[model samples]
Target: MKRINTLGAGCLARALAFSLAAGGLALPLSAQAADLPAAVAQDLYENGGVEHWLPKAEKGDIFAQYVLGHMYCNGKKVEKNYELGMRWYRKAADAGFAPSQLAVGTMYFQGQGVERDRDEALDWFTRAAEEGYARAQSNLAALYLGEKGVEPDYEKALHWYGKAAAQGHTVARYNLGMMYAHGLGLDEPDYVAAYGLLSPLVENGHRAADELMQSFLGEMDEEELVAARELSEELQAQDRMLVALDQRAANR
Candidate 1:
């Protein structure tokens, strides 16, 4: 399977797949944070996985609770237990940990440890996304793109995707580019917009973006191409700025 960014599992727990695939334990990283974040991050790496985190989580450390949730959900160190995972996630999420809010939202969306409720998922996701969590923003954008039993709201989708893409979320950038290509939620397709977004990915050898970009060559005129090229430069600059901002905040 292609490892595109966003939450690998239907826009859920952002780093759960990475930890599972790596055969190790780690904390989920957030896009924006002050002392690193208004989200769960950092500390879990130093003390260790389940053993150490369990105590901290119990003592009301939001970061530890969030990491503990991942371990339980993925069966990293402890046996897989969805109920336990949800409990941990809820604890941190209750404390306004954005990553755990995402995890709780994922569970609600997927019915992993709780009854599936799309509205509940939306509520949780909205909370985290509003907190400027990039993964949650991407996930919320996807939902606004219309999941089962939900209405598609292109404007809302674009808003969330724009936030995430600016923060360097690859999947959000690709999806936004694709929306431009297909005119999803728009009056007409914006070839220049699509080209601006996809062109760099193509340069970087992103196969999906390359294939989509190839389709554009036949559709766009010379002027559109020039405009697209300029827009691409601008978008790339914005991406660099946002990424640097995220890094500076993370290192703070």
Candidate 2:
């Protein structure tokens, strides 16, 4: 698939490029603390209390290590130290923490504390994606589509995008919808599938998806429009069920 940069450019290329830029691959300090205890996590954000997490981080608490890494990276309570942040991230990642793995991958991709290494970033992203981290799956899809280092692989991109989209990742769903709408890397366009994917995105106030949906409807026939609406309803119901299942799993 060809890549284009402009927002109003060719359908598929523009959508894919927009996704690459808009979907930030990095995990911010707050996102890094998502797996931590709710009370402690909130306190860290509200008070910037790195001291509370430092001892636990030193004691090899995986979540604490990730939090310290985030704090150091953002200079929350400690001086900004990318190297120290990477060190803590690595400790947690080495223990198979998916979020820390994603953080390390982001650092490599952005050259935050180390040299930019797209290959290494891809490796770490693959690790986290395999562990069922939706963000990593989305990032991996972007990298595959963008051809950061390796040759562009639309098939691999679609696979990762589908995995992330199935987990209700908005960006991935938007990208997948665009791909289907324009027949990007496909033998034929699948407007019904595209409409189904984009419907929820438009409802969620995604301007790009809304614009695309308007364009799509202008081109679709009455019969196709009716089918698309039915398909969209089905997809939304399935998505809700998956979300409920995930919540139940998290509670357990």
Candidate 3:
């Protein structure tokens, strides 16, 4: 597979100064939670509405700003106002809150309230990704994989996917597996790698992975199936992916 050029001009790696952390990955978030940065919004909103977060957001609390942003954007006890949401998100984002950055990037990507700007979206995603935010990294990879204004950049996509996958991001791992299954950025599809990457997810009840496997199974022959089983067995013995993550973090 073609690797992303980290040193390329205007690449997502412009924020590569930060090093990966050495630690076991957190338990993966549900796909829905991974897609949006509002996993905590409901809980926060239930605990207190906009009235609770307003003063703190104004006091320059990034967490409060983020919660306030979510409430406004989601119309939780307040009218939906993308502009107000963006305003609060920007405040926290400017202060380097990863979730807020993801929120702002998502808004830009979706053209919510603000004019849709792919470049701006990429910028915010890159910022949060630099902070080792897995969702931002996954979103960044998706943008690089396919976006209107941005040309498909497979190397960049793979790079960010690996970064996010190393953090136990299900969506990133699924996307990376799909790319391999289709031979994208590679000489040919590698069923072993693809199946190995996805089988665990399928076993874990990822409906999408199970659906994809329906198509993929027809393509793999007996020998490939054997290889895939061996890969699975090896994973049970030692997690190669986690080791790779550790090495990358150690190097950093």
Per-residue lDDT of candidate 1, residues 142-229 (tens digit): 7787754569898888778778888887777877777666666665667777787777778888787776667657777898789778
The alpha-carbon deviation from the true structure for residue 93 of candidate 1, after best TM-score superposition, in angstroms, is 0.7
Best by lDDT, which number? 2
lDDT of 3 by residue, 1-252 (tens): 333222223322222122111110111212223434474645453566777889888888887887677767777678878899899989989999887887788788778879988788788889999998887787777767664456888878878877887778777888776765665555566666667777888899987766665556776789879977776554433336746433423543
Query: Model 3 lDDT vs. the true structure?
Result: 0.67
Best by TM-score: 2
Ranking by TM-score: 2, 1, 3
Candidate 3 colliding pairs: none
Task: List, in order, the clash count of every candidate structure.
Answer: 2, 0, 0
Order by lDDT, highest first: 2, 1, 3
Q: What TM-score against the true fold does each predicted structure earn?
A: 0.77, 0.81, 0.72
Per-residue lDDT over 30-118 for candidate 2, one digit per residue giving the tens place of the 0 to 100 score? 66555557997777666545768888888999878887887788777788899998999889988998878888888887798899888
